[model samples]
Target chain A: PNADAYGAARERLRNQARPAGSLGILEEVGARLAGIFGTIDVRLDRKIVITCAGDHGICAEGVSRFPQKVTPQMVYNFVGGGASVSVLARHAGAEVRVADLGVDWDFAPDLPIYHKKVRKGTANFAAVPAMTREEAVRSIEAGIEIVDELTAEGPVHLIGTGDMGIGNTSPSTAIIAAYSNIPVPELTGRGTGIDDDGLRKKIAAIEKGLALHRPDPKDPVGVLEKVGGLEIGGLAGLVIGAAAHGIPVVCDGLIATAGALIACELAPSARPYLFAGHNSVEVGHRYMLEHLGLQPLLHLEFRLGEGTGAALAMTLMDAATRILAEIKTFAEVGINDAQ
Target chain B: PNADAYGAARERLRNQARPAGSLGILEEVGARLAGIFGTIDVRLDRKIVITCAGDHGICAEGVSRFPQKVTPQMVYNFVGGGASVSVLARHAGAEVRVADLGVDWDFAPDLPIYHKKVRKGTANFAAVPAMTREEAVRSIEAGIEIVDELTAEGPVHLIGTGDMGIGNTSPSTAIIAAYSNIPVPELTGRGTGIDDDGLRKKIAAIEKGLALHRPDPKDPVGVLEKVGGLEIGGLAGLVIGAAAHGIPVVCDGLIATAGALIACELAPSARPYLFAGHNSVEVGHRYMLEHLGLQPLLHLEFRLGEGTGAALAMTLMDAATRILAEIKTFAEVGINDAQ
Candidate 1:
């Protein structure tokens, strides 16, 4: 958060063994992390990805084009190792575990479940508060518990939060508006490939939710309890935990950005550990990125959730760290002049 | 290339564990290589990069913004491991070696050198032929010899071509125009970030060369003798050798594209093994890509040519091969969805 640290990081990156400003924004990210950690030899070791799957109560409002069943189906896809995030996790060589934060489905009692299902999904947040404040805190504590368990084994190097909830973007937009103080219409967008008509209905639903909640922006927890989804609350906890434990966190698209906005409100210093993976097609994503003053690594018009963009951006982070760690300095190579 | 074999290769890729068209252009490339090598599983082993360093006589015609000395200076950068290609090759995990194809420098005999200099770089083709037929043959033979030596040691999986020559774009434009039959002015671009005035002069110089050479498009060898740089001729040989030896070759940006165009002419079947790495900012690159019917994997607006694009693209090839070799099929994993 110190502007001086940002300047020093940029200076260190400029001094790396390459042309000035050649690596582009990746150079700045590496430098910023180096300055934050107060070490030139910064490495990402305990990479953690927490995939939170839930069902959106807003699905009852008929907002998403896809059936709400797709949420559970995609979670099965993740568990069955057939989802994009599964393949991406293999590529990133990161540890991934799923959280059943608040999906409607009830699992067998002895099954391997990481987090609690606070309720069988929320009431239609369009007409009422998604969950009670107690339920929201319980979900946040679920995420905090995961981070605590993972970091107890070792220091988490980087944390990535992903979500799998259909019709959740309406809730996300409302949360983004409450935290960022942006207009509701500007923060609304077509989630899961909704048409213009669907987008209009979605925006109107979010406006109703905002009216019902009347969230106070000064209190982060109060704002989340008013408008946020369970996954958003869990992600906020993950972000706070990673920052508290001195691990960097890379936030995925719009939904994750909403979580990060709350995390920043809770602990302002968490913004430094956060890297925006890519700009999502969601209008609210642009608002969140602009509010956070973070630029994404790639812009291939990707809007898929499930942390695919974050996984791909991790490749760039690996590359940057390798360059900083492996490249021989001018002194080591001993090149005289331009010869 | 056998059309049947190519079809079979495509079938194998489509039958892979992932979704159809998920790998994009790489799926086609891997399939085509499978056809070339007559194997279902293709591995990228013994990757080789042939860096052709030369001096363009057009530098004498004031075609380049940088001095002629930068060509040899960059060659030293490549050899000393400071150039972009050097870092890219380190990332690609490939073996890179430089060839002094036609630089205007006398070197010690004991130095590690591939002495295939053709009259200390070509004559200014705007005024005269870039190289005589005999000299062109010599340069091509030198490139083939390098490939033969490398492949003789073991199976050479991927061959990438890079070049270092000041004002080489002048020769590259002439070669591209001769091959693509496009207008010289339309194919010429500002090489090495030339200004508007420099670009106009470069175009004028290429037009003059086209007037002087009047190359026959049908005769690939004759066209090379008339207008191609020594590095282009060498690249043609590299491509030919890779095809004859049944090795996949990855071609870099515009200059390498010119070499690939010549190779495709010399042996039409060789086109199957050629992979365009990335689209460069060079004006002739799009025409060259069109002629080859190859779509590059990445479009990063990269103009810095050192075979760095090819080297970076090699990472994708590596990823594809790893999937082919390591990933378990549905049947192997005991999943009923096996194709």
Candidate 2:
């Protein structure tokens, strides 16, 4: 299986002449790929970041602290290059494309919007399922179509998934609990700095959805249709698509973590392709990371949810790859040390 | 007179339209110059880093954990692009030039070594004064001449000072206490991860030197000649030279701190040109920072020398300059806001 390829790659990278485990989590990334590809000569140059933007009907219930108008404001901020992710992408030298999967507002026809909205946003999942089964598959296929287009450009070395949706974390937490098999309390977090009372309300909403759709863990796509947001379902599709195509993907904070867990449940080998960027201050983040058996690199108490963490983590990846490819061997440098 | 310019510049940078105290110590760097140049439109394109290397005769007394050979080995590491400061300079887009002011070993003729040795390092400053008055002046003048040549290429915006000398901390501690009018114990620190017992011995050595010199703090150069290492004297000259030419200089950890204290004593205006990089983990670092009335930005418990800290701090300067120069005005963006 693909897991064997990742295991081999990790062994080869670790066996290279250096201090053992000196590279830390970077070594895990390289090893994971080596096992995925079944070869030691792995390369990571082409980077593609997919940002999914949607709107939540829960906003109508006054669940979020920020006005729903701020969603479009931030989308414009992304376009105007003022968002944190914009600077981070510039720092990482990665190409980014934004998609509007289910935003309530309309964007220009020529603005790279995917136009994959399923009813202009989800129905409040606390009240009912966000989308029907067929609609979830359609959104996921939209993400798959984007990956197919990106793969045509070149060998897609890495994929990063980011989401922008007001109140989407509510659905994401529900989907994570359904797939991760953790209790709703363990999977819920203070999304967007919600107050203690708001957190309690959010947890209650997730538990209500869990009661309505008792999803089977064995069928992740079925579970996603039962509870996940359109963006989360789309991200899950992207992860599975990248792994099926043998491309590595780095997952950003909590929302992306939920997507990865769903992808892994769908195809166990998909776990080999994913790297967790950082642990967010979100309470659900620890449960997600633990479920995935992942250890993130930086822990600076960051809770920003714009894929900024993934972009910063990419810098460390660049450093790791440069060191792996560029450092001279002992024989090449005339050093007498034994490997 | 120069100190007045520094104070004025510090005020203007603080008044820029942004979050109050958001840019941290970088605000002071900009403001210090606003006072001097009478404008916030400042430039920092050309940078010069002076690395002064010597050998401490106290190395012969087994005071340091690293061998005296490490002094030259690190010099080679700097030249070979393997040292931490080398990578940091490349990151900061700054130019680095090394000066072999004094080392016991003679290097190859074409090795880019600056022939400014002061009697193959110094007599054990623990046992005697490190250098004579004539030798100290010669070393300082050599540094001045180097900066003059470097500034001829362009308008030097920033200057940085670093050094390489084993057992140099003994002399540095003596200089810091004598100049700051602090007790020897208050000014001593583990220079390079020295043990608790070793630190006690270092403080004893500094106390002994203070007893021998009893230097007059008013006569900065005389104080330097009596207690300073060759590298420290050279750095003091570089600081003064950069200020005499109206270029801002960033002072590194402890050794550079000693040099800045000397520069301020010699030409009070030069304090405006000096930016302290970080509060190093050395026990004396906080004292040096307090004496200079500076607040360092980054605090990662770094004690490594070789100007690495200063090089990293330069990145923040780049960020600050970009914020000042590149961020759009509310009026320009057509946003109505109270300024």
The model with the greatest TM-score is 1
lDDT of 1 by residue, B177-269 (tens): 887778877888777767788888888888888888799989888888888888888888888888888888888888888888988898897
iRMS for all predictions? 5.7, 7.0
Q: What local lDDT score does residue B97 receive in model 2, on the 0 to 100 scale?
A: 79
TM-scores of chain B, in order: 0.93, 0.90
Off by over 4 Å in 2: A1-49, A58-65, A80-84, A113-119, A122-145, A157-163, A166-305, A312-339, B1-50, B61-66, B80-88, B107-119, B122-147, B157-163, B166-229, B232-339
lDDT of 2 by residue, B229-297 (tens): 788877888888888887778877887777777778887877767787766766677777787787764
Instruction: Give a tens-digit lDDT track for model 1, residues A93-209.
Output: 676667788787876665444656777777787777788889888777777788888888777677888877878788788877886777888888767667788878888888888
Ten residues in sequence with the least summed lDDT for candidate 1 chain B: B330-339
TM-scores for every predicted model: 0.77, 0.66
- Each model's total of backbone clashes: 0, 18
